[model samples]
Every structure is written in structure tokens, then in C-alpha cells.
Target: MVDAYLSLGSNIGERETQLQLAIEQLNMTPGIRVKRVSLIYETKPVGYVDQPDFLNLCVSIETNLPPFQLLQACLEIETRLHRVRKERWGPRTIDIDILLYGKSIIEDEHLSIPHPRMSERAFVMIPLNDIASDVIEPRSNKLIRTLVQPDDSVVKYK
Candidate 1:
């Protein structure tokens, strides 16, 4: 199985429940096994600023599926959870992003591993550091822990 990391966030409906159910869905998928999950953090919205605060967390999974298939599974889970794509970085019931896929570097028309912007987002970095601090981020060749700094905008969710 290949080790992969995912970041999940929700700002609509029961936020925490959304995150939990997403975790359950991921675990139930055929080739994916949810391993470690970081503590949920409540963070301010990034792109569109006017939405409700989001509940964010990162997850580590072992999956036999390839990167594209893994991405498909995440999208399927989001659709099942009622995520709507109405705007760029818009609010949603749940958002699942594939952050890393076993040191793989992929740049396709539909997907980008290492998530392109993950290093710049505190919401993704903080929680990711919780579980995979020592994992090397291929692009920067630096530890996940060293690439991030605590931000005032992200706080531990209850």
C-alpha cells in the first residue's frame, strides 16, 4: 500500500460531523485505510473571506489505489457529503484535498500532488505537522514541520 496524506475541511452543516463522516467514508473505501488523523482545528477562511469559519484537519492513509484513482475516491466522498462547487475556494459542506502520495510527483491537468499550495496554507500545514512532521515534502525537500509556523488564524477546535 502507498502512504498518502489528505486534508479535509468543512464550514457548512455540522462541521465536525462532516469531518468525521468523511473520515469514515475514506476508511470504508476499498483500497484506502485511514491511519492517523490530526486534531481538528478551526481556521479562518482563506480565499473568499466572507464565509463561516472552517473546521480543518489532516489525515494519513495507506492506499493501494494510484494517485488519480485516489483523487477520484476523494471527489466521490465529497459529492456524497453534498459538497457543491459554485465558486473558487467557495464555502462547502466538505472539501478533501490530496496533499501527498507516497513521494510521488504528479502534475496533470486535473490533479497536482503536494497540493501545489499546501506549504503556504497554515490550515493544511499545522494539522499535517501533527501527524507527519518528519515527512519530506518533495518540492521543497524540507520536513513538513519546518515548512510551517503557527498562525493566529488557526486554533484548536474544542
Candidate 2:
């Protein structure tokens, strides 16, 4: 199975519960097994500033599914938790993003492994550092820990 990392966030009703349910669903998927999860962090909305603060965390998983298939599974989980993509970076019950897929660098119309913007988002990097600090991000050829930076907008969720 390929080792993969995913970032999950929620800002709608019961934000923390939404994240938990998504994790449960991911673990329930036949080809996926969650290996570790970071402590949840509360982060201010990034792109769309009008939304509520989000509960964010990252997970490391071992999965046999291909990148696209894994993306499909994440999307499926979001839908199950009532995610509505009315706008980019809009409020949602749950948002799951594929951050890294093994040591692979992938760029396709449907998905981008090592997630295109992960390096720039402290919200993604901080929690990712918790679970996969030494994991190399293929595109940058740098360790996850090296890529993380302090950001006031992100803090541990109580």
C-alpha cells in the first residue's frame, strides 16, 4: 500500500464532529487505513474570509488506491458529510485535500498530489508536520518540517 497524507477541515455546524466523521469514513474505505492523525487546529478562513473559523488536521494513511481513486474517495466523504461547494474556499461541513501520495508528483486535471498550495498554507503545513515531518514533499524535494512556518491564524483547537 502507498503511504498518503490528507488534510481535512470543517467550519460548518459541529465542525469537529464533521472532521471526525470524515476520518471514520476514510478508515472504513476498503483500501485505506488511517495511520496517524494530528491534533486539531483552529484556523481562520483563508481565501474566503467571511466564513467561520475552521477545525483543521492532517492524517497519514496507507492506501492501495491510486491517486485519482483516493481523490474520489475524499470527495465522496465530503458529499456524505454535506459539503456544498457553492464557491471556492467557501464554507463547508468538511473539506478533504490530498496533500501527498507516496513520493509521487502528480499533476492532472482532476488532482494535484502534494497539493498545489500546501506549502504556502500554514493551516495545512502545521498539522502535516505533526504526522509526517520527515516525509519529503516530492515537488519541492524538501521535508515537511522545513516547509512549515509559524502563523498566528492557526492554533491548536481546545
Instruction: Report the number of the highest-lDDT candidate.
Output: 1
* Candidate 2 accuracy as TM-score: 0.98
TM, every model? 0.98, 0.98
Clashes of each: 0, 0
Across residues 97-121, which tens digit of lDDT does each residue of candidate 2 receive? Answer: 9999999988898898879999999
- After superposition of all CA atoms, the RMSD between model 2 and the true structure is 0.6
Give every collision pair in model 2. Answer: none
The pairs that clash in candidate 1 are none
Clashes of 2: 0
Error of 2 at 51 (Å): 1.3
Lowest lDDT 10-residue stretch of candidate 1:
149-158
Q: What tens-digit string does per-residue lDDT give for candidate 1 at 128-152?
A: 9999999999988999989998798
